[model samples]
Target: MAATLDQVRVPRARAGRPRTRPDRVLADKGYPSKANRAWLRTRGIAATIPERDDQIAHRVRRRRRT
Candidate 1:
């Protein structure tokens, strides 16, 4: 679930349009699978999701590029 403030309160505090964009977003690991990250990148959202442990290990072993 979204934070309570986001769901019911923050919308009313928007300074401009209802679709006002954010300067950045902070996210947890669960939100940044490959496809999700790619989609967010396509839209220019700066995602801060960290790689899962298994993903980190695999990347290290294979020298995969981000």
Candidate 2:
């Protein structure tokens, strides 16, 4: 999916290099795993995805344990 996103080229109005990357990406909780978030971060793309419910619960449980 990232590769496919990189292949996209949006033309510029003033005759410069077309945009090869997007400013941000919107995704649902299903796509917000640590690996996916890290991958997007490495590419300098901002992602607006909510964490999974299980992940949230795990964090809460871990905090309580600590």
Candidate 3:
């Protein structure tokens, strides 16, 4: 997904440089890994991907322990 995002080019409505980064990314659970999220954060891209079931469960367990 990161590789795909790197190749994105958003055409400008006016005469200007094309956008290299997108405003946001909407993806499914398959793209919700920690590395992917961190990469998007560093690049200032917003993600709307849902957490996987195991990730959610792990989060819940960790919260309960604290």
Would you list the rank order by lDDT, best first? 3, 2, 1
TM-score for each of the candidates: 0.61, 0.76, 0.85
Between prediction 1 and prediction 2, which has the larger TM-score?
2
lDDT of each: 0.60, 0.83, 0.93
Name the top lDDT candidate. Answer: 3
Backbone clash pairs for candidate 1 read none
Model 1, position 31, has a per-residue lDDT of: 68
What stretches of model 3 exceed 4 Å from their correct place?
Answer: none
Which of 1 and 2 is the better model by lDDT?
2
> Each candidate: how many clashes?
0, 0, 0
Q: What is the C-alpha RMSD of each candidate to the true structure, in Å?
A: 5.3, 1.9, 1.3
What digit string (tens of lDDT, one per residue) describes model 2 on residues 1-66? Answer: 567677888677797999987778888777887888898899899999998889899999999984
Model 2 worst lDDT run, 10 consecutive residues:
1-10
lDDT of 3 by residue, 1-66 (tens): 989999999888899999999999999989999899999999999999999999999899999994
lDDT of prediction 2 = 0.83
Better lDDT candidate (2, 3)? 3
**For residues 1-66, what per-residue lDDT tens digits would candidate 1 score against the true structure?**
134213332243647545433435677777667776676666575767777898889879888564
- Predicted candidate 1, C-alpha RMSD: 5.3
